[model samples]
Target: MTTRSSPLPARLKSLLLLSCFLGGIGLMHAENWPRFRGPSGQGLSTEKRLPLHWSATSNVVWKVAIPGEGWSSPIVWGKRVFVTTVTDQSTRCRVLCLDRDSGELIWDRTVFEIVPLRKESKNSYATPTPVTDGKRVYAVFGDGSMAALDFKGGVVWTNREISFYSRHGLGASPVLHDGLLIMPFDGSNRVLKAGIWPNTSDEERLGWQIPWDKAFIVAVDARTGRRIWTASRGKSRIAHVTPNIHGTGRKAELISPAGDVIQGFDLRTGERLWTAYSQGEGVTPSFAMGEGLVFTASGFEKTTIRTLRLGGRGDVTSTHVAWEQRRGVPSQPSLLYLAPHLHSVTDGGVAHCYQAASGEVIYAERVGGNYSASPVAGAGHIYFLSENGETVVIRQGAEFSVVARNAIQEKTQASMAVSNGRLFIRTAGNLYCIGSKH
Candidate 1:
């Protein structure tokens, strides 16, 4: 006769359920700040208890000096931190990996070397931030050179098919989706002479001021670095805006913005799906998307915040535009969309909060300092890092309220990264990991 097993004890069952419930909480808070603007690529963080007040000395878990020069922000994966820099007079491109906990250097490897391209004094040769898939780190330099390195500093693959040229240099980072690494080459055909600020005439600024058909977005196989497809922007000028994916699965769209055009492309096949004319050149701020709407800043010329409703075909300039705001559009920093509220700080130090659905300005105030690093949100606080390395922290609400103003008193241009309840800040000379000591 077969014997029947006894049921688990009531106490044991209760213990098991409680253990699972706690495990769920741990998983929820264990998100990585993987890319340029964290995992979402839109400067949003879900981890709580992030450091609210940190200076050069206080609350700093660890600090280390980074070699070379780069404006590329630190990207975190698991226990490793990855960042790229160009040394040897911006010719030697190097990628550095550090331990996430104690801020120790794990490995530093030079991926490749290239002749330095012309860039603005404020921009670096390694301006584009690196992206990782938890397996390998992918980086792109100013000359359209891409490299992938494994966690152990092993070079995986490199691609240098496109000869990228831009008057202001490349600043847009690559995004990884479905085993493909996609990057936009919205560069101009003309390269400005060294130390030249303004062009002599309109004829000398064909690619920068006038639209060109050679600008394209290319996708490569993540594993092999083989070209997957190239999507042309038709006729568009230069822009530094990075592309973000909208939706998921087969219906997803790659939302790409150039100087004068914001277009949607089929993520899988690289086909242009829709377009919206945004007149401007040298567009820097990456767009933000939420609630079935895409928000972008029309760069340079007539700087304005334009919101477009999703799901449109061909030219959606007139049909899909939901609202437009002209008061406080940021030219450098990207937009932060937090539910019903949108937050942005202009390069001139003016911060504004707006209603996400209506384009109504809730508050317009000056927090101080010139801002280039994009603002990051966590623990219901928005942290806006300025060029002078001062972070103006504000609470997320209808009324503009300052929470804390923290300063490291250094030169900083790269955006901040958050992960595991800690903030990774990259200044001109050092990388600081900020967290509570307790």
Candidate 2:
């Protein structure tokens, strides 16, 4: 009789160790907004006691003018806060680092100037939020210039290899996984006119002399800013969604939205793992991970939301789909999954709660305004920011219940950041730090 021995492959064992390594360290900088949707990319802040109410004139700890125009949210690390902005002529790109407590501008560095300007009315030049790893801060502009600066605002390294179209501007934020800083290049290859974005492909889909909108993700060394890997995302148009890291039993993959597909790539080498064919095009929604599923939403054309399961080899569309939801998914705003319940506000202001596991609607009610910014979850409450400058707090559960409604005097389309037990909200005019500070 022959005896058989069973063992795991060396590659599989290595992947297991990688997963363990990522899990051991904390994802978010507890007192920092390192990426788009806060730490862990779920929009939930582990803050102990965030303020429940605040206004333009009351409960405001400090207010600071943001300089030029860019709707990017603020990210803070240690004592420094960072945000990106562009000049009024849309030529010069800059990043400002401020003192976290005093709101003092520590360093304002001009990154670059656009040679030939390109911009859409709806998109600004510096819409992508910067990412920091406590040591250095990274920012990318609409012109495809990526730069890194030390905590003291000294230039570390800059890359001007890629050239991106300036239309609808670059809104995708950068993220850090392991020691690599990842950024997305998603936009039209050529200049897009105002009336060309709608239902016509003749004038809208013309190829550019340089294919900047090839739909790809690039990873760079966090410390040195060297190009580590570049993964192509096929031929897709513009996407304003930021990428997030997802955990599997095997390894953590960078989950990103490209056109009508949600893809997963190897975190270290940018190897394409898998891509799920999302039914909708022009995907602007980011991924939310929880309950063993990755939720993705689309913006234009066929609007729908799909929940995908993690860990699969090639196109795992059939094997990994957990559930799908079609009602009230936001085009621009990201969704929040709070175990057993998923909450999101549609572009039309319909606040919804769905059973995350089953994709069944628990409640869909109107909250009364448009929402472009993603909500922040903290202290057992969900804070929804509307375009009309209203912050509506609701209890997080299956049933819908409003906790409080706080309205700022100014209109804001930017998201809120919670760090170091304080809520930092970026409005159209100023950055307000809301907390007791006592």
User: In order, what lDDT does every prediction score?
Assistant: 0.91, 0.79
TM-score of each: 0.94, 0.87
- For candidate 2, give the lDDT of residue 148: 91
List, residue by residue over 285-344, the lDDT tens digit for candidate 1: 998999999999975888999999999999999999999999899989999999898888
Model 1: runs farther than 4 Å from truth?
1-9, 12-29, 191-203
Q: Ten consecutive residues with minimal summed lDDT in candidate 2?
A: 204-213
lDDT of 1 at 188: 79
What's the C-alpha lDDT at position 270 in model 1? Answer: 97
TM-score leader: 1
Q: Could you tell me how far off, in angstroms, the CA of residue 342 lies in candidate 2 after the best superposition?
A: 0.9
